[model samples]
Target chain A: MDLAPYLLLAGLEGLVQASVLMLTALGLSLVFGVMRVVNVAHGEFYMLGALIAWACGAYIPGPPVLGFVAGLLVAPLAVGALAWAADRAVLQKIGYNPEGTIVSTIGMLYILQQGALLTFGPDARAVDAPFYYTIRTPWFGYSSYKLFTVAVAILLVAGLWLLMRKSKVGLLMRATQFDRETALNFGIPVGKVYSAVFAIGAMMAAVAGVLVVPNQQAHYLMGTDPLLLSFVVVIVGGLGSIPGTIAAAVLIGLSDGLLSVFFSPTLAKIVSTLLVALVLIFRPEGLFTVKGRRA
Target chain B: MTKLQVEGLSAFYGQSQALRGLTLELSGGEVLCLLGRNGAGKTTALKAIMGTVPPSSGRLVLDGRELTGLPPQEIPRAGIGYVPQGRRLFTELTVWENLEIGLMTRKTGREALEHALELFPVLRERMQQRSGTLSGGEQTMLAMARAMCLNPSVIMLDEPTEGLMPSAIAGIREAVIRLRSEGVAILLVEQRVDAVLPVADRVAFMDHGEIKAELPIAEVRANPDLLHHYVGIAARPARPATC
Candidate 1:
């Protein structure tokens, strides 16, 4: 048995998983970082994106590319608008109290899940990949679409980094994250920032969902696994650290994929769970904290 | 001339009232120091005027514009700069970003920022560094410089010299004097009479959430007993008292 082929396949699979997980976990981290709100309903937004992509494939005219492109644009915007409305209508009313947010978001989780089940039905729907091209190696052939997903995730991450580091809007978000009262005193509409952050975060997850749907399938219950995995990634990455979130996503995503291929899926989950427990015990501030600043 | 008039400003935290019918005024080119003991509503009045703490029944007017019902975020845009207690700089942001926030609020450009940086020359070097890592004195300068970036007609500093050394305190006093000469109204909240006497044109002694008296700096300097009465601290002598 050639171990090289097996390892190569596992690595490629890991990259795909990591790419999707990176976008999903980044969204979770960004929301918690700025708003300090734990949105348990984040995965529901991901589910919404995938389901919306399925709907587009069925209803939209023209080629698969058109449907995929439509999904890419419509899913995030729709999900983001819904998230913004929910934030204003619900989260803002509660003042974003940590305990209240957790409970309220859990309520949102159920509402969205049930809503998806009703609208999209309880079936697992498959989405056609935009391109049929494949890269053939000596031992096997791989889907080019998977590599496209990785490339797209990287580009989105880079764009997000620029928006955060270089833009005035990013500065306002960071200032609010540092000190809400000070941000308010300096004429930053902190309430508006919170609403926008919440929306942007959900949009990130929604985009990831649309990207991954071609590889997987859209199901109302599909959000559970990604949500759990995302929680693991976010906690391990540090509470509000963006760089940490990305690093953690890659680390866990690759490990889970490799372990599932080599050993067992159950074993992979056990390992990830233990990792989170260890991180919580050893470095509660996270592995990537610098002087208490969430870089 | 620009003036800030805070009339009948009453604020409460839950059932407990922090400010009761607080009234004060500061005209351009003058520094009005608010002197009081701890919990005497000095900070509360500033917060109410800034629109952070909701005023139960009061009016805040800045040069004929009503700021009473405006949001806290709007107050700064209405030309009131506030440096709250503890120099609440956005710790995660760079020094330049903190000043950028102020400049952005006022919609002022690089010229205003240059003017602010000129006041604290040292901040020019540390503009790229995170504000949280700065020394206490440097942090105070950054806070004051940030407040000044907006070119506001009124600036409120709450306990600006609380934890600073003599040199930093002098820098704050100089900045206040410079701002006054530039026709900006200032509200300085201080517990120390020594820090206030040099820069304050007039002092308002606050006790139990109301201004007990507003006296000229000369009158307070002449009557040291007045400081002892309201602020609960005797004016220190020029030299340390011999045991």
Candidate 2:
């Protein structure tokens, strides 16, 4: 049997996984980079997005595509607003103390997980793809929607790069991240920047969740795997470096895909976990850390 | 005209008091040097007025506007610029971004950028360089230029020459003189009597968080013991007054 088709399928799968992982990890990186606070509840935001998308499909009257689009528009905004409120109410009150934020976000994670369980129940549910279009090849057929996801991910990443480089809001965020006291000295409203950054970070995860809902089932406990995977990506990429996050995501995502196809899913996860450990021991600053830049 | 007034300002860090009912006044186009020994609360006084350290009790009025209890971010918007000790530039950002952040609270746009560049012309050439990569003297210039970009009516300098060489010190003195000529009120904090004497119109001696004496530069010049008593420095021989 020719291995070309199988390898191509694995590569495509890796690209799709990498696309979602990058979006999710980028959100985690932004929050950690700017706020210096670990958000343990990040994956819950992704789970919430998927569940919200499922609800939109089930309840909204129209084609599956309409509900998917609605989910795309609504999930990020809703999740972002919730994240903002949480930051102001909990994170700010704690002064964003590193240890305190970790515990607080853990509490948040449980609350969100339990809330989803109570609302959506324990069963896993799936949503239809917005438009079922397939690209057929002599060996096998592929889902065009998966490719569409990759395209969307690239656009979002480009938009983020432009926002960081060219916009005033981006400048404020960068300043705040570099030196909070200096940022305040120049009237950057560091508090507002914190709230906005927290929200935007959660929104990134939510968008990824919405995008991946068609391919994966929405379950209350689904957050665990993505949460773990995202931590791996962010750490391997280096803390606070967006380009690093992207490169790491692709590295880990593709390796996981190929490993799973050739070996086993369990082995794939073990390899990723071991990769993080190796990176930690060898390159603690991350694979793409810039010299003199804070990690 | 009085540009800033601090009436009985006090501040604390935890249970320890840093400023104790400190009072001072700054007028347009004059440099008022706040002189004190280490830990005499000179930096705290500036921090209190800037709202970085919330004054425990007191009133801060800038040009007849009550500044007490305003957030730190709002202080710069109220026409008071601060070049904090250590030249706290956003080191990771380019010199231009640092200046751009200063311009955030002011609408002077390109004109303010031009003014700051004029004050420190070397900064114009180093606009795109990350502030952290600059030499110490250049960092000081960038810090001052960033503050100047606010087009402030009043500006405060907290030990701007603390770690600088003599040439850099001269650059700072010249910049202070130029700022005074532009009619911007300056509240300068300095330990070096020579550095202060050239640009300051008056000096306020602070010890243990309280202002002990306020005198004209000539008064401090005549009373050598005052410097020895408050700041612990022997008075230098009289030279031609520069201000």
Q: What is the lDDT of candidate 2?
A: 0.91
lDDT of 1 at B77: 93
For each candidate, give the interface RMSD after superposing the true interface residues on Cα: 0.8, 1.0
In the range A1-295, model 2's lDDT, one tens digit per residue, is 5999889988999999999999999999999999999899999999999999999998998999999999999999999999999999999999999999999999999999999999999999899999989899999999999999999999998888888778999999999998888787888798999999999999989999999999999999988898899999999999989999999999998998998998988998999999899989999888888866853
- Given candidate 2, what's the lDDT at residue A4? 91
Model 2 chain B, TM?
A: 0.96
Candidate 2 structure quality by residue, lDDT tens digits, B1-243: 999988999999999999999888889999999999999999999988888888889998999998888889998988889999999888888998888889886755898889889889999889899999999999999999889889998999999998899889888888999999989999999998888888889999999999999999989988999999999989777544342
Best by TM-score: 1
Model 1's i-RMS, to one decimal, reads 0.8
Candidate 1 residue-wise lDDT at B23: 82
Stretches > 4 Å off in candidate 2: B236-243
Query: What fnat does each of the candidate structures reach?
Result: 0.91, 0.72
